[model samples]
Target: EPEVTQTPSHQVTQMGQEVILRCVPISNHLYFYWYRQILGQKVEFLVSFYNNEISEKSEIFDDQFSVERPDGSNFTLKIRSTKLEDSAMYFCASSVGRSSYEQYFGPGTRLTVT
Candidate 1:
């Protein structure tokens, strides 16, 4: 079975540094999304991409953040400048394109900014 995978399960960075958290989403899926959870808050959707274009994005996806499909199997999120508030667990999810289908989540990448 194929699944999403994220790198550097944990990362420590100074506020102001750039961080590129990587994810390889399952192939044969048409939708990809990025979400984040601040230690205790609800998971917030950042953006959704499909067919090589952004399908939707939330306010949290500000100018400092961007995503790309670098190759056939890799999806990446880049934070231009990290802030203390940026500390959170970033999750990459994929679905079979249905409200009833469960979106599979990666273990997650925990980013910490000081």
Candidate 2:
């Protein structure tokens, strides 16, 4: 079975700096999403993308955050300005359809803002 994959398993950046996290979701999936877990907190939804446009986004996905499928196989999350509170294990997930509850998640990219 195909699985989602993320780049730069870990990233460290200074506060206020920009960072882009990359991922490759299962090629056959139709819905892609970005989520983050702050330390011991629950997983929080950031944004969901479909057909080259944003399908849904949570409050956490403010102007500072953006997602894109720059190509046929790559999906990316960009944080315009990092803050200590932004540090977390960011996960990229994909599902076969919008209503599919079974999402495949990548190993995750750990982002640390200093």
Candidate 3:
């Protein structure tokens, strides 16, 4: 089975800097999502996208955060300005449908802000 893949397994950046986390989900999946897990905290949803537009977004996804399907296969999360609180393991997930059971997650990109 095909799986989601992420680049730069770990990333370190200065506070207030911009960061773009990339992922390539299973080719056939239609829905994509961005989630983050803070140290010792449960996973939290950031946003969900479908048909090249945002379907839903959490309060945590503020003006600073944006999601885009830049091309046919790439989905990306851009943090316009990072903060210490943004440091977490960011996961990219996709599903054939909107059901939770169909979702598949990537290894994750660990973002550490200084």
Candidate 4:
């Protein structure tokens, strides 16, 4: 199994704005990723595009957010404009199987609807 970590377990935001959470995943993993959870909802894979070109991404991965494979170990997603619905649990995850495809999730997305 892989290791994962997320920052600011909880976050509060206004009606319209932007927020970027952070995560640190297993050091030896190959694939890095992000996901989100709408309170009391199922976990959704926002994006899974890899190798710096987005191998895959969800419809939710709209213009509002952009992701980057900045380096060998860090992957980041930035949101340009955040609406009240943007509030959700943001999770960072990692996987070793480029083919096996098993993902381990960080704490989670808890974006409050304000």
Candidate 5:
């Protein structure tokens, strides 16, 4: 079975620098989403994308953040300017459909901002 994969399992960046996290979900899946978990905090939904546009987003997804699918298989999240609060483990997930489907989560990319 195909599963989601992410690159650079861990990322370290300086505060105020731009960072891009990459993910490749199962080839056959249609819906994609992003979630983040700060150390010692609960997992929070960041955004969901479908058909090349954002379907839903949380307040955490502000002007400083963006998501894109540069290619058919790769979905990426970019932070225009990193803050200490942005440091967390970002997870990429996908499912066959958005409603009542089980989401498969990637191993996650840990972002450490100083």
Candidate 6:
């Protein structure tokens, strides 16, 4: 009965500021991912990480965005500069295997930018 956890459940920031969203996936999970959902939009995959390195990334994950596994249990996503378009609910997910495994998602971090 393990689940993902995120910090700063809600965040508000001015445009162009840097933001870091934190997540802790299920302790035994190996595959981690970052996804975002803009209001009224579909959930989109941004990046995936495994074995302390990035395994896959979408176009949405550009130079302005980055992900890191600072330690064994924590994963973080950092946005170098925030834009109005970046305002969305970011979700962290993890799975036990590369394919066919269920991905468990966190409650998400709602980011609002002005």
Write one digit per residue (lDDT tens) for candidate 4, span 1-114: 456877668777766667766666677666777888777888888877455677778899998888776666666677766788887889988887677777877886466646
Ten contiguous residues minimizing lDDT sum, candidate 4 = 105-114
Misplaced by over 4 Å in model 3 are: none
Per-prediction TM-score = 0.94, 0.97, 0.97, 0.82, 0.98, 0.98
Q: Which of candidates 1 and 5 is the stronger one according to lDDT?
A: 5
lDDT of 5 at 99: 85
Clashing pairs in 1: none
Candidate 5 lDDT over residue span 36-68, tens digit each: 999999999999999999999999999999999
> Which ranges of candidate 2 are over 4 A from the true structure?
none
Model 3 TM-score relative to the real fold:
0.97
Give candidate 6's TM-score: 0.98
- Relative to the unseen true structure, what is the C-alpha lDDT of residue 102 in candidate 2, on a scale of 0 to 100? 93
lDDT (10s digit) by residue, model 1, range 8-113 = 7999999999999998888877788899999999999999888887899999999999999989888888999999999999999887684677788998999999
Q: Tens digits of per-residue lDDT for model 3 on 65-107?
A: 9999999999999999999999999999999998555789999
Query: How big is the positional error of residue 17 in model 3, measured in Å on the Cα after superposition?
Result: 0.6
N/CA/C clash count, model 2: 0
lDDT of 2 by residue, 18-92 (tens): 999999999999899999999999999999999999999999999999998999999999999999999999999
